[model samples]
Target chain A: MNARGDTTRKRLIDATTALVREVGYANVRTRSIAVAAGVAEGTLYRHFADKRSLFYAAVLDRNAPIVAATATLPSLAGRGTVLENLLEVIRKLAQLQEDLLPLEQAMIADPTLAPLRGERVQMPLEGPPHDIARYLAAEQSLGRVRAECDPTLAAISLLAMLFGLAVHPLLGNDLAKSELLGASVSYFVDGVGASATQPKLLA
Target chain B: MNARGDTTRKRLIDATTALVREVGYANVRTRSIAVAAGVAEGTLYRHFADKRSLFYAAVLDRNAPIVAATATLPSLAGRGTVLENLLEVIRKLAQLQEDLLPLEQAMIADPTLAPLRGERVQMPLEGPPHDIARYLAAEQSLGRVRAECDPTLAAISLLAMLFGLAVHPLLGNDLAKSELLGASVSYFVDGVGASATQPKLLA
Candidate 1:
C-alpha cells in the first residue's frame, strides 16, 4: 500500500488497540473504532474486513516485537549472568502475557474468535517456551545451569511463574514491584531450596 | 426442590455441561441443551432464565468440588513428606486449571459473561493462590521450609508452574508425566541452587 494508506491503517489499528485495552475486544465496534481513529466507518472496512479482523490486526501485529525478541533468546545464553539474561527474557514475556491477557480474555468469553487467534498465534510451532528451553540448553552446555536440569521443564517453569505473576494483579494480589521484578527470577535461578550459606533444619 | 425436581435439574445441568464442553459457551443454545437433556425446550427455561445462567450452572457449579478441595490445601501441610503432600496439592490444582481452561476460554471469547462469572467466582476474596500460600505458611511453621523463603511467592510459583504445565497441551507441548510431577516439586523444595549434594560453580 501507499504511505498515505499505511498511515490510515496504522491509525485505525492504534485506535482499536486502545479501545480493546479500555473496553475489551468483545465491546469493540467498528463505528467507535473509526471515531477513535478520526476516520469514517467506511475507512475501517477499507483497511479491514470486519471488527474481528481489525482487532486481530491491532493486537497480533503489535506482537511482532515480542516474537522477534523471543527469537533472540537463544543467542543471549552465555552473554550475561544467567540470572540476568533469564530475567530480561522473563520480564519481556510477562509483559507479553499481560499485553495479550485482554485478547485472551475476549477469546475465552467467545470461543468462536479462537480460530482467528489461532491464525495469529506467534511461533505457532514452538513459541517462546521453546526458545527459552533452547537458551537453557545452551546455558547448560556452558555449564551454567545444572547439568541434570531439564531445560524444557525449567523453561516452562520460568514462563509459568512469570505468567502467574503477571496475572496476579488481576486476581487482586498486589505483588510488590520487587516481587514481580526480582523475586521470581531469584527463585527460579537460585530456587527456594536452602543453600550451604543458609541454616539447615529438620529433614 | 423436590426429589424429582432435583433429578431433572441435575439432568439439565449435566447435559448443559456436556454441551458447553463440546461446543463451548458461545455456541451452546438453549434448544440443543434441552435436546441433550432429554427435556422439552420449555423445561430449560423453567430451570434457567437464559443460556448464560445455564452455562454458569453447567460449569461454575461443577467447580464447587475444585474450590472445596483447594480450600483443604492448608490442612495437608504437615501430614506427609512435604514434597509428597505438595505434589498431591499441585496435581489437584493442575487438574483444576485444566478443567477451568475451556471455561476461561469461553469467558474470554465473550467478555459479557465475565460479570456472571464474577458473581459465580468460587473464592470471591482470594483464590487458590491464597490457599496455597496458607498451606506453605503452615509448612514453614513446621520448619519444613526455609526461614527466608516467601510463602506467597512459593505458592504462586507452584501454582504458576502447574498452570503453565497444564496449559502446555493447549500449546502443543506434551510434557512427560515425570516432568509434571517431579520437576516443579524438586525445584520448589530442593531448588536448583547448588547444595552439598550438587556441585557449585558460578559466583
Candidate 2:
C-alpha cells in the first residue's frame, strides 16, 4: 500500500472501529466513517468499495484471525482434561475487544455476511463436537464417557452454555461485570450432565 | 372464584396473547386487548391492574410451570447421560408456543418490563444458574463429572449456546445449518485451554 493509501486505510478502519463501538453494526456506514476520519466521502471509496466490503474488512482485522486461529485450532486435542482446555478457549474469546463482540456476532450471523466467511477464515477441522467426539472416543476407549452418548448433542449443550454467559453479561446486564466475566466457562466445566436423570418423551 | 371473574381473567390473557402474536410486544396495550376481547376498558382494569401487569400475566402463562413442566423438571434432573437430558430439554422448550419465545426474553430484557417481573412470578432460585449449580452438584457427587470443574460457568455456557441456537434460527440461516450450532457447542465442551502455544491474552 502507498503512503496516501496506507494512511487512508488506517483512518478508515480506525473510524469504523470507533463508530461501530459508539453506535452499533446496524447504524455504522461508510459516510459516517469518512466523516469521523475527517476524509472526503470519496476517500472512503478509494479505501473500500461499499459498506459490506468495509464491514468485512473490519471484521477480518478485528475478529477473523483472533477468533479463528484460537477457536478453530485442534482445540479438542488437549493433553490435559477436557475442562481445562475448554476454559482456556472461553477465556481467550471473552477477552477479545468488547467493541468487537457486536461486530463478531453480526458477521457470524446475518447471511448477508456469508460471502465474506471464505478462504480467509476456513472453518476449523477439530470443531468442539469433533473434539468431544475425540474425547468421548478416547473415554470410550478408556471407558469413561458413555459410547452411546450423543457426542454432538453434548457438544451443542456445552457450547450453548458458553454463548449464554457472553450474552447475559453483554446484552442483559446494565454494567460490564468483571466477576461474572470468567464465571460461565468455569461453571460448565464442573459438568452438570452426568447427574441429570434420563429424559423420556413428554407425553 | 365467581363465573364473571374467571371469564374476565381468561378473556384478558387470551386477548393479550392474541394481540402480541398478531402485531408485536411494542404495539400491544390493555386498551387494544380490552377492545379485542370485547370487554369495556374499565373491565380490563377490574381484572388486571395495568398493561404491564396484563402482559406479565400472559408472559408467565407462556413460561409458567404448566408449559415448562412438560419437560424442564424431568429432563434437567433425570438420570440420562448428560447430552440426552439436554436434548430433551431443548427439544421440548423448542416446542413451546411461538409467543413464549419473545416473551421470556422481552420480560427479562427491556427495563419497562423489569418491575413487572417482580409482580408476575417469583423464581424459587434466582435463575437457570441455580438449577445448573444443583444439577452439577448432583453430577459431581456421583463422580460422573470432573470434580475440579466450576459448575456455574459450565451451566451458563450451556445456556448461552442454547440461547444462540434458539435465536439463531430466528436471525437467519445460521440455525438452518445446525452444523454451525453443533460445532460451536462441541468446541466449547471439549475445546483447548490457554497454553504456551495457544495463548489466551487477546490483542
Residue range B1-203, candidate 1, lDDT tens digits: 78987888888888876765566675677898888889999988888898878766756656666667678878886676667777776666555555555564554445556664336354311467788788778876766665566878776666656654544324413333456446766766664222444432211
Q: What docking tier does model 2 reach? A: incorrect
> What TM-scores does chain A show, candidate by candidate in order?
0.78, 0.62
> A12-53, model 1: which lDDT tens digit per residue?
988877776676565677899999999999988988999878
Model 2 C-alpha lDDT per residue in residues A1-203, reported as the tens digit of each score: 79988888877877887775565444567789999989999988977888767776776566554445344434354355545665566555555535454554444323344454244642211244455445544533433343444655555454444444444423334213344445554443423222123331221
List, for all models, the DockQ compared with the true complex. Answer: 0.34, 0.15
How many steric overlaps does candidate 2 have? 38
Top DockQ model: 1
The sequence of per-residue lDDT tens digits that candidate 2 reaches over residues B10-125 is 88887887775554454576688989988899988988888878877876676564244332433344375544444444444444524454554344323355553234364211
Highest TM-score scorer: 1
After superposition, the stretches of candidate 1 with alpha carbons farther than 4 Å from their true spots are: A18-46, A49-55, A70-80, A107-110, A115-127, A167-181, A192-203, B22-24, B40-42, B49-52, B70-80, B116-120, B124-127, B167-182, B192-203
